[model samples]
Target: MRTAATLGPRRRPVALMSFVAAATAMVFGVAGCGSSDPAPGADLSPAATTAAEVVTVRDPWVKAADKGMTAAFGTLVNSSRADVTVVSASTSVSPMELHEMTMKDGKMVMQPKAGGIVIKANSEHVLQPGGDHLMLMNVASPVKAGDELTFTLTFADGKSVQFSAIAKPFTGAGESYDPGHPSMSPGMSMSPST
Candidate 1:
């Protein structure tokens, strides 16, 4: 993926992970609408398997961009199966691609990933900004607080899981490890982990 040199004047991407390569992966995206209602046919049943595990994406959120661009972050995990390929993703925007941001040749570039990301059945992948972030090109509208969006993950094995994530104001922070974000610094205090 190709990423912009600076997500903003204050936030610098620090997360390290690839959006492509087809071997263990992650993806993040913006909220199409605000989060409040429930998804149709929401299923929390355990997937029958030889091993005890839950397949899901963890902590997904979108970071606001000043220039009508927004980035997504989250974690992908497969605790039961070792062969899972993310076929595709659907969002409010008709066009969405798995992207990664990094300092390449002294510039930030964001680009679409080749093929798709493959996750080993029992491992996890991180989708962090400045690295493997989901970019919503030509944002439909100005997403703000109280807005929720829907994202569906399609697996290679014909399984589609729909999850809803809300858009949080981007104060320079990008998910869990955006140290260069405007909200953090060496002199700043770190909140205790719950």
Candidate 2:
């Protein structure tokens, strides 16, 4: 797994003054992102206060080996002084859910847990095939290996995190990241381009 951070241009630096002032008091501060409707710099509900726990989540990637079913995996990080719970997720897909890929009845299955996965304060979780992941059902288009997907995460406190993914299949894909997703894989992985 590799990690990198790239900050984008601030869309609203002025409107955020008040929010920033409040967040600064709590010791958490983040340049607001998401939503074209937010005032100059209006933040996504949970302002960054030191006690506010800031988080950065990467959208899940559907392994190239995906067939009728597959999973998109990524990471979530709480970069704040406090802790938080990721309440929900909002994406282009409907009934957007947080699902887990684990061994059930001794067979690898991607099932939805009771509540959304918890992203601990200052902690991280990896949503990968054969593990915790976001299940994309009936993918509208075929995403070949090397394609990308964009998604957003809605936190319990109402904060939003956005990220994208580059598609890749599991090792030998037929089994490693298989989620039996129904719309993801067909027991095939792309051939290597030599």
Candidate 3:
């Protein structure tokens, strides 16, 4: 047998080059088998992959107010496989707070939500007049009917979603904001008017 050591220097180089080319071709052929397409049962939906994209607000509306404080109501829908929490909200119109209504001293009272508003996976959280809502405090300008306000809701994962809500006149909730009252405990009161 003619070994590489006995072969001419030029033939030795050509044989080495052929071996290298064959190895490269084999490696690339194996690598090309991995298709760019997602595997079967893989989730390709935007909501399933993103945090803020998974949550959406439906029928969003703000309670019209001349000044002071007001609230926004809507249905928060989460379409992801995991739950999402609305940790905070922001807008140029006013400072926003996540609030909830609860019974205190035999009366319904509105208070700042301690943790946040949690929207369960594939479910909805209703922000109604007498339920969990977004409170706009010390509005810089009057919110009139038909006026649209943009708000950014920050999630627990530091992701945020921007949404627009139309202001609508509503006066039947019996909700009142008193920043000075000690009984309110850092929020407004939602006691029904007697």
Candidate 4:
């Protein structure tokens, strides 16, 4: 059989390009098959903190909504010697509050996290949909797909970090809202925060 070694160097570039194209197409095709939600900003690059090296935020993004409530999702990693608590957050679109969703009596309920979010030292905290996330209540302007929102997180130690999140349209109704538990079935209902 004529192997790649025997095919000579001229045909190598063509074979490589074809292989790359096929791989890229396969990746996109598989990603599209997972959920009906648009994956436009799913591949956003994680951003780092410029103010402090001990804390780093990654994969920050916001859900697209017209004028109501929405949330910011991301991962917060703490590499410091002491624990850090995110006391509050502020955004130009609306007022921000730390909220969490959970399964209560076979229903998903959203509530305000009174003490805010805590990221322990040498550990990571994930702020995502159906879990502990930053809430944007009563948004003034419309947040459409491909839009960016800037927000700043203030810690208890008076240190703050600023980041931007890309807004993408999403349907969070189907999420189970169970933090760290995936065995539960999809579909979560949220009640007004108390």
Please report the candidate that would top TM-score against the real structure: 3
Arranged by TM-score, best first: 3, 4, 1, 2
- The per-candidate count of clashes, in order, stands at 18, 27, 0, 0
**Which lDDT tens digits does candidate 2 get at residues 1-194?**
43344555546777688788887866632444435446876555443453223667655565553333345677877766455665556545333557765676676545565567776656787776455667554445565789877777766666676778777756622233334444344653323210
Write down the lDDT that model 3 would get: 0.81
What lDDT is reached at residue 71 by model 1?
A: 62
Writing each residue's lDDT as its tens digit, candidate 1 over 84-146 gives: 667667787434566655455555555555566666667887877556656564456766645
lDDT of 3 by residue, 1-194 (tens): 99988887654577889999999999999887778857889978544566687889999999888876788889999988788889999889988888887777666667788899999888999999878999886689999999999999999888999999999888647754433444344544443420
Per-residue lDDT, model 4, residue 80, is 64
Cα RMSDs, all models = 29.6, 19.4, 9.9, 18.7
Candidate 2: stretches off by over 4 Å: 1-53, 58-60, 65-67, 93-95, 171-194
- Name the regions of candidate 4 deviating beyond 4 angstroms: 1-53, 173-194
Compute each candidate's TM-score over C-alphas.
0.55, 0.55, 0.71, 0.62
lDDT of 4: 0.75
Model 2: lDDT of residue 148: 73
Give the distance in Å from residue 165's predicted Cα in candidate 4 to where it truly belongs.
0.6
Candidate 3 clash total?
0
